[model samples]
Target chain A: MEFIAGKYNYWIYVALMMIGFYAMIAKGNLIKKIIGMNVFQTAVFLFYISIAKVREGTAPILWDRTVLYDNPVPHVLILTAIVVSVSTTAVALALIILIYREFGTMEEDEILRIQKNGSAVPPGKPE
Target chain B: MIDFALLFFLVVCAVAAIQMRDLLSSIMLLGIYSFIMAVVWTRLNAVDVAFTEASVGAGITTILLIAALSRTRRMETKQCVPPANLLIYGTVILLTSAVLLYGTLDMPTYGDPGAPAHSHVAPRYLEKSYEEVGVPNVVTAVLASYRGYDTLGETTVIFGAGICVILLLRRKI
Candidate 1:
């Protein structure tokens, strides 16, 4: 019970991660896969933020001269990660649009079928 | 009380986003998931992280995804599920979870003051942030001053991504 009590947060995040992992691999639609990737990234952010928590600690502000502050490093690092995630999503969405324009579909299997059959809609040609 | 409720909400949103068939609904659920994660970060005293997550995760990401969805099909077409692929993914996920769980067993408790993470360079930043950078929010100070190069690189990467998107989607390409 003590083990469970102390580490439930990690366990929950891990489960959340698995959900995202399953979605990324098993989902048919490309957009759903992107959403899964976001969930996976968010789970990681939660894990890092959870690590930054301090017992009986306040937010990382220096208002009081003698107050315990949670670790600020993880918070700082996650900022960059969050920004990168947005950029990645933007790029991914743009690529998806291009894929749609070229193949007329976003379903993975359809895209593969079109590619395999090598129809007139050869991808990457400036349309 | 709020923690349990919020975590539960997060799980619901993540699962719903995964299982949702309509692309629009899935995108909305993911937005909600990001918003709830921001709230959870706040509850955990990571206000800055929460702020970033809210803006980037909940705000811009959802808009981008919606824009893409509008340009693409709304419903997923039928595709035959492959048991072999499922087995491969399942085996990989199970092995990863086991490894992660093993690593977690050695991690410091949720809020241990003496954890190595806290004892390392974190203390010096807390000790001298006001003097070195004179910023009230140590996170901002560290992010801007101590880690300025990383932030600059991050900005460059975002700028590059914007350029890539424009080149890929715009008529100019």
Candidate 2:
């Protein structure tokens, strides 16, 4: 009970991480993979932010000398990470745009099939 | 607790986002997930992180995804044939999660003031930030002033990504 009371946050984050992982590894669509990557990244940010919490702490703004403040390091770290996530998402979408133009399908298996059978082979699914 | 409820709702959104047939709706649901995740961040005393998550995750990501969807198919192919080796994949995911849970047993409890994360440099920043940096917002001070290199690195990465996008998307540059 004690462990459960104290560590529920970690357990919840682990579950979220697995959900993202499952989507990333199992989903076939290129965009689905990107969404999964987003989920996975946010789950990680939650883990970092959760640990930075202190029971009675206020937000990291130094409002008064008597008040406890949450750890700011993780907040700073996650801020950078969130921006990085956006830039990566943009770049990935650009790649997806090119992949669509070249192959005309976003399904992972279809892309692989095209790779194996060559572009001259009509796509397995009729357009 | 309210936290658990929010997290449970977040999980539902996550599942629904990935499970949707329309890629557009999936992206929208993901925006909701990030919004709620931002709320969770505020609850955890991370206002700055929550702010970024709200703007970048919910706001920017949704717009980018919709733009991407314009160039591609919105509806996922209807064939729901389960991936091969799904059982093996499930087992692997579960085992890894179990190991991570085990590892968490040694970690400090939620909101432990003495936790390693809250100790060390965090205390120094909290104590000295106002005096040394004159920035009441510790997160901003740490991000832009104290740990300037991380911000610089992030800026470089964004610049690189922008150049990569422009180069990749052009028909003939």
Candidate 3:
């Protein structure tokens, strides 16, 4: 009980990461995979932010000399990371659009079957 | 108490996002999940990060996904993977979770002020940011001046992604 209480935050984030990971690996739809990827990334961010928490501390802004503040490093790191995550998602969405244009579907199994059979979409051109 | 609620909602959202058959609703749950994440961040004193998560994670990501959804099939078309293959994937995921759970054993307890993360450069930044950078918000000071290069690199990456999106989606010759 003590162990669980001590690190419940980490444990929860770990579960979130696994949820995202399972979606990315086990799900068939391309959009589902992308959603899973975002969930996984956010879980990592949550873990880092959790590390920066101080029991009685305030936010990282300078309020008073005598006051404790949460660690500022992870917040800064995650700020940049959040932007990078969106960028990756944007690129991913773009790729998904092109994939749909070429293959006419976003289901992973369908795409793989098309690739293997080389029948649904022509080899060189989409026609 | 609130933290527990938010975490519970988070798990619920993730699971529901997985189980949802409609691609649109799944994306909406993803937004809800990101919003809950932002709340969790604020509770943890990551206001800047929370703002980013709300804007980027919930707002931009959902928009991009929905727009992409507009470009493709809306409903998920899933054919079951054979049970043997499903079992393999499940085993690997569970093993990874076990290893990560093992790792948490060594981590500092939640909100321990004396944790190693606080003993390093974080303390220095908190102590000297007002003197060195003339900024009250240490996160802003560190993001803009202390680690300006990384932010610049992040912007460059975003620019690259923008270019990539334009390249891939624009069909006109």
Task: Please report, in order, the local distance difference test score of every candidate based on alpha carbons.
Answer: 0.88, 0.88, 0.90
DockQ of 2: 0.69
What DockQ, between 0 and 1, does each candidate earn?
A: 0.70, 0.69, 0.73
Q: Between 2 and 3, whose lDDT is larger? A: 3
Candidate 2 lDDT tens digits, B1-173: 89989999989998999899899999999999999999999898888889889998999999999999888888887555465668877888999899998899899988888888888888999999888899999999998899999999999988999899989988531
Find the 10 residues in a row with the least total lDDT in model 1 chain B.
B72-81
Model 1 pairs whose backbones collide: none
Write candidate 3's Cα lDDT for B52-171 as tens digits.
Answer: 899889999999999888877788875687899899889989999999999999998888899999997888899998999999999999999899898999899899999998887786
Task: For residues A28-106, write the lDDT of model 3, one tens digit per residue.
Answer: 8888989999999999999999999999999999989999999999999999899999999999998887888777888
Location of the lowest summed lDDT over 10 successive residues in candidate 3 chain B: B164-173
Evaluated at residue A127, the lDDT of candidate 2 is 25
Evaluated at residue A33, the lDDT of candidate 2 is 84
> Candidate 1 i-RMS (Å)?
1.8
Clashing residue pairs, candidate 2? none
After superposing candidate 3 on the true structure, give the runs of residues whose Cα lies further than 4 Å from its correct spot.
A120-127, B171-173
lDDT of 1: 0.88
